[model samples]
Structures are given as structure tokens and as C-alpha cells.
Target: MNETSNNTVIDERSDILETLAKHRHFLRFTTRDLTDEQAGQRTTASELCLGGLIKHVTSTERNWADFIQRGPAAMGDFKNMTEADFAKRADDFRMLPGDTLAGVLAAYEEVAAATDKLVADLPDLNASHPLPEAPWFEPGARWSARRVLLHIIAETAQHSGHADIIRESLDGAKSMG
Candidate 1:
């Protein structure tokens, strides 16, 4: 994908964008022919639904992209989060009222576009940001924009697999043979 920024065509990010798009496609493919109720239904004991997985991936990508641009502040203080914060975070994996599969997919597409645009326009992927204070991260650790992109790719790919399982359980459909 060649993106024009300030009258300059940027293609350096095409590989990354294409890779991400492929994963996103697989995730969305699992929802084909699914109704809103089916998308929201928990197929397995894991409490994961197709729409919820898409929602979670969308939120994660947006947050990570923000982290790439605004540093750790974008994620807020995870270490200081309250129980309510944790509860709210869990909402990402739920298909809340009024959420439709179409809406969830649309949001994911929007986030994907924004992230791709950021990758294309970003001045330096090597620019680093100190990670937020979270249990999963090592203290004093930092990540470059490129690292953040990889993290996003990993998260999307991982969740795509989860979605595939959920979809298969919901129906006989399979994302892959």
C-alpha cells in the first residue's frame, strides 16, 4: 500500500501493512454469513466471541499505535489501575449492547487504516519509548515504533487464531482447512 504524505509517496511500509491486512482478513473471514447474535455468542468456554475478538483487536491496535506516537502516556498507568479499570478493560472482550458485527468490523478497519497511515508517515520507526509500568513488561524497558508494530501484528495474529476457534465452535465453518 503506497500512502501519500505531504505529496510524497511512501511504500516502505507496504510489507508491514500487507502482512497486517492478511491477518485481519482471516479474522474477519470467520464472521462471514454470521448474524449479530451469532457474532456475539460465546462459542467456547473461553468467553470469546467473534465480534468481541474483533473489538478487542481493534482496541489493542489503536492503543499500541497511540503508544508508538505518544509514548507510555498513551496507555495510562496500568500499575495504578483500580478494579473498575480492570473491569472496563474486560469490556473489550464483550459484545456490549448495540454492538453489531458490522460495527465491530468497521471499527477495526478504521483503526487498521489509521495504524497503516501512521506507519507510512512516521519519521522514524527506530524511535523508542519507555514502556508503561505494567507487570508484563520489564522495568525500564523501552520499545521502538517498529517493535510496537510487531507487537500489534503479533496481537492481531494471535487473536485471529482465537477467533478461528470460536467461529469453528459456533458453526462448522473453518477459517483454514
Candidate 2:
């Protein structure tokens, strides 16, 4: 690659890494002062709580890293999955009974590691992967692996903001910074 193209690639990668780091920072902050109950408690009507958000983020990372990029054949027949599949996945976001705060954190850590490996091993930012049969994504449109990574980073950051607000409302704790 030419110097300019090389610089662009470096810049893009840096941005992706920075976004991931920001999400991880906020996630850690949200979990900072919470007891196990507080972490798992749903303060509002929303399905997301601190722990739930962690679980959701971790699962999303795994889905993107393992299923979406690598292929979905191992997970079973996703060929005919529809909007219901998306809804079912969304409905599964809640923290189940016996899911501990530590478990959620550990899962997030593992997902983060997997995501790091995916990003590191990716050949190019523009390489695209076919979106599985899901409503949220176009059926045949390809998604760049870099874009997927960035999307995960963005999604985590957004949920971490929610966690910060919920954590504050649950108790007067404020660690959003």
C-alpha cells in the first residue's frame, strides 16, 4: 500500500481500538460501585440493567466474532431465521436466575478477548462478510468486519450510558467518567 493508504488504514484501526476502549471503560465504571444485587437489579421498566447490559454486550461480541464473521453453520440453521429470531435474541437479553455479577464480568472479559483476536487477525478493513438471515441486516448485503467491530463498540458504549443512568437511579452512585 502507498503511504497515504497505509496512513488511512492505521487511522481507521486506531479509531476502532479507541472506540472499543471507551466502551470497556464505561462498562467497568458502571460495575465499579455496585453490589451483586445492585448490578442485577432492574431499576426501571427497561429490560436492561448493569449486569444484563454486560451479558448482552458479551453475547453480541461473541455472536459477531464467532457466528457472524466465522459462519453460522455451527450454531444450526440460521438460513431461515427471520425477524422473530431477532426478537427472540432480544428477549434473551435479561439476566437469568443464578447469573452472578462475577460471571457477567468474566463473560465480558472473554468476549473482549475474542473480539480483540478477531480485529487483530482481520486481513483488511474493507473485507466484507455476508450477513446471516436476520431482519436487522440486509439479506445479501455484505458487512465489513471492521464495521462490525465498530458497531459492537458503539453498541456497548450506548448501553454503558444506560447502565450509568440506571446505576445512578438505583443508588446515588455516579461513575460515568
Candidate 3:
């Protein structure tokens, strides 16, 4: 069934997809009329920029979707990450050399398409995988695909708000009134 089917009853997957799409729209809207340099410009005390926010969100969504399919292996062992590893990961929050706003948005769209297909095709949302070994996650915890979807939605929504702030600070444009 369509994610936005007119039927009275909507499935959990459709709801998840719809919520995700809405947040994605808000996030992308924040980039409207921005040049590559503008998109990469840090608008506030925080290090976040519009293009970087999109880049981070795209990577995050792709990883979580992989986790839903391939278990904790999808997330590399964080316990042994070197300082350089962390520094490299931190690059996701910046628009590096040759990075363009259009390119970043294109990558996000690609990831989003793949994630949507995975959600629609997954055999069971109840299927779960162990949490990766990370300080932020509970030890020995597992997450259902449903939980991952919720997490993705939350992540997208939170970043969308951040993007709005960055966009407004960059100039006076607001994603929403």
C-alpha cells in the first residue's frame, strides 16, 4: 500500500515513512536559495551548517537502516576508535573541500530512497539486532527495526530544527513561520 494511502487504516510502516518525509522536507527547505558556501557556513556558535546537517543526517540514517538489516556489525566497534577516527567522523558536520549543497542534498535523497525501500520491504519490524558497543547505548541491549525507525524519525526531526536555526542565522530565512 501507498505510504499515504487514503484508506482509513494506516500501517505502522506508512506512519513511520510519513513522519520521516515531513521532517526531511523541513530540513531540505532550510537550504532553499542557499549557495554552496552559504550552506557550509556556520551560522551560530555551534559548528553545524545546513549542508553538514544534511550530510550527518544522511550518514546517520544509512547506518541505522543498515543496523536494522545487518545487526551491530553495521556500526563499527566504537570502543576501539582512535582519536583520528573520531576526528574523521566529526568531518560529517562540515562541508569539506569540493562539497556542494546540491551534492549533499543528492546524497541525502539517495539514502532516503534506499531507507524507504528497506522499510517497505522488510519482512518484520519485530526483527531485532544487538546494540553496537557504544557508551551512548545500553550494554548488551538490542533494538527492533521498529525502534530503529522511531530513532531515525527522532533524529531527522531534531536535525530539521537545528537546520532551521542555522538557516535563519545564515540570513533571515525560516523553514517555518
CA shift at 163, candidate 3, in angstroms? 0.5
Predicted structure with the largest lDDT when compared to the true one: 3
Model 3: worst 10 consecutive residues (lDDT sum): 1-10
TM-score of each: 0.92, 0.82, 0.94
Put the candidates in lDDT order, highest first: 3, 1, 2
User: After superposing candidate 3, which stretches have Cα over 4 Å from the reference?
Assistant: 1-10
In candidate 2, stretches whose alpha carbon ends up further than 4 angstroms from where it belongs are 2-5, 72-92
Residues 34-57, model 3: lDDT tens digits: 999999999899999999999999
- Which wins on TM-score, candidate 1 or candidate 2? 1
Model with the higher lDDT, candidate 1 or 3: 3
lDDT (Cα, tens digit) per residue for candidate 2, span 90-138: 7446667788788889878887877776666666767666666655567
Among residues 3 or more apart in sequence or in different chains, the pairs in candidate 2 whose N, CA or C atoms overlap within 3 Å are: none
In model 3, what is the error at residue 111, expressed in angstroms? 0.3
Model 2 clashes, total count: 0
